[model samples]
Target: MGKANDVQFERARPRIWDRLYPYLSILPALIIIALFTVYPFVYAVRISFFQNLLTKPRSHPFIGLQNYEEVISSYYFRSALTVTALYAIAVVLGVLIFGLGVAMLLNSNIRLANGLKIIILLPWAIPTVVAGLMWKWILNSDFGILSGILYSFGLISSYIPFLANPTLAKISLVMAHIWKEGPLAAIFFLAGLQLIPKELYEAAKIDGGGGWRLFRNITLPLLRPIILIVIVYETMTAILVFDLIYVMTGGGPADSTALLSWFAYAEIFKSLNLGHGVALAIIIALITLVLILIYLRLLKTEEINV
Candidate 1:
């Protein structure tokens, strides 16, 4: 009886190990995530409830939600919020239009389509800081290539300060952002366009559908999912934009380009107010989370309707 029991126990040990193996394999990754992401987030949240100024590092005192209240009630917050809103809206629309147009053009059998398909992704591959620097040089008031070209063509009396004027600065930022991000969106759209069956277009043509008619009915409907994805992604990217602003504008010319992220950055680095910065960071995170949830709800509704 004792020998039989030992055999049964030995057999069950392997079964138990097999059941636990998958989680054991991924335990290291879970530990790393807890250390890096989860721990930092919780610590930051705790810090936001305290007066964690770098200058007074040894004297952090619990201040509850004062940091949140102060950040929200400030003038800079209002201005940054407005600028962020405008930037997000313009970027989303610009990227969508540019991406869809480029995708459609690439899908066509034009002579330069192959060459363009190769070159279009270059901008997306470059780092954001590098792209911003390139645009800064291109838009330089005194000796920019664009200014020189315009001068040679007699299009302007002199070089324009693209980064100095508030309105033009906003426009220039939008253009640079679109140029940097539009390529990925175009690739996404092109992939979606390719997946669409040629037979559907042929059938539509048989039913007397022209370019606009076929696009409005067939192409647009089929690409709805991709469009929603692009919108959500681009919206988040636009909201969290910082590197470009740092490299190009520095939130300059009267804070016309200061975004929420930039505001948080200024609070943390420039002002050395860790609590306020963390509070603002949490607010930004919540805003993005809400937007993502809304977009996800829309995506679900779309899927159900289709």
Candidate 2:
């Protein structure tokens, strides 16, 4: 009877462990996320409601919604909002078009495609600050490589100041952004393209569909999901662009590239108004959340249609 009881205990022990295994496996990650992500988010939310300044660090009085009100009424807020909207639109379009073109080139069986793949990630692999500084020098008015090339080829009489003029500074920022971000977008598009069945293209061709017809009917419809994701991601990235503006133009040329995120940084670091900075950050978070919700709705609708 003792031996029989021992055998029964061993079988029950295996069953009990199996039931708790999934939760046990995930416990460490949950603890880490709670410590890092959850804590900071809660702290920021608390800061947004109070008057917290580094200069007056000892006194953090709870001002209710005063910080939010001040941030909204600030002089630069409207200008920053307008600039951010325009920048996000331009960057999203540029990234999508550039990425799609590269994805097509990569998908084709060309002689240079292999060489192209090896170098495609160089722009994205580098740090954003390093990339911005490199572009700053490359577009310098006095001794830029691009200006030198253009002058050498007789395209221009002299080197143009790429980041000195308001319009040119905006254009230069977009160009630099596209160069740095286009590679990752290309990788995403390439993944989507590969998932498409070859039989679909062959069937379209057999049905008398030409190149444009095949792409419009098959590729575009199938790529809709990826396009939605890319647009949303790129829009968020553009709206929050800071490091490039910080390193390259420094929001110069009359604040042409003073995006909302950069505006928040200036408020905190340059002006030393931590309350305003935190308030702006909270507003940014809300804007981003709204945009994400809209895109997710569209994605769901597209799925239902399909």
Candidate 3:
């Protein structure tokens, strides 16, 4: 009986290893992720409920959710939150609408279409920091190319500070975002557009469907998945915007352009409030999760309909 049991155990050991081999191959990546992403996340959550002295080490007290309450109640946080929400919405809408228009244009067999596409893709290919810097130069109040052009056209009497004023700062940031992401969005839309059957358009034409009608009936329905993906990506990108604002406004003019990411960063590094920063970071993560959940729900509905 002992010999028989030993043989069975030996056979099962190899079978178990065979079953687990694939997972074992990915174990290193899983370990790295746990060490970096998961550890930091857990640490942040722990610190969010603590009162930590930034300048002094090894001094922290558990304070429940007071940091969250303080961050929520602050006027600076409230205003920045509003600006962040508006910035996300505006950038997403502008990128989608403008990108769709550009995609439609590129889909046509126009002259220099490839060249145009290459030019359009420049923004997406450019490093974000470089793009922000270039725009800062162009949007500078005194000697910016745009300011010069506007001056040449006699649009305004004095130089307009695009990044100085709160309203103008938001507009400038949105414009930068559109320039950076529009081409990427167009590429996605173009891919979706190609998958749409040419026969569908022909059929629509046979039924006396005009351009608008065909687009409304066929193009939109077919492109819903790509559109949803773009929306999700754009939303997350906009919410987490930091580079543009950092380069352009520096979250200045009384923190007008302070997005949630920037807000958390400012709290941690600038103000040296680790606890408050961690709390804000957690809030940002939660908001992002909520947005993702909404997208997943919509995706599920679309799948069910299909």
Model 2 agreement with the true structure over 1-306: per-residue lDDT tens digits: 255568878788878899999999999999998899889999988998889888898999999999999998988889989988998998999999999999989988998988989999999999999999999999999999999999999999989999999889999999999999998999899999999999999988889999999889998889898999899999899988988999999998888778889878988998888888988998999999999999999899989999
TM-score-wise, the better of 2 and 3 is 2
- Per-residue lDDT of model 1, residues 1-306, tens digit only: 255568878788889899999999999999998899988999999999999999887999899999999999988998899999999999999999999999999999998999999899999999999999999999999898998899999999999999989999999999999999999999999999999999999999999999999999999999999999999999999999999999999998789989999989999999999999999999999999999999999999999999
**Which segments of model 1 are wrong by more than 4 Å?**
1-17
How far residue 294's Cα lies from its native spot in candidate 3, in Å, is 1.3
Model 1 compared with the native: what TM-score?
0.94
Top-scoring candidate (lDDT): 1
List lDDT for all candidates, in order.
0.95, 0.91, 0.89
- RMSD per candidate (Å) reads 3.4, 2.6, 4.3
Cα TM-score of candidate 2: 0.93
Stretches of candidate 3 exceeding 4 Å from the true structure: 1-20
Q: What is the lDDT of residue 280 in candidate 1?
A: 98
Q: On a 0 to 100 scale, what is the lDDT of residue 91 in model 1? A: 100
Model 2 segments more than 4 A misplaced: 1-6
Tell me how far the alpha carbon of residue 32 in candidate 2 is from the true structure, in angstroms, after superposition: 1.2
Candidate 3 TM-score to native = 0.91
Ten residues in sequence with the least summed lDDT for candidate 1? 1-10
CA RMSD (A), model 1: 3.4
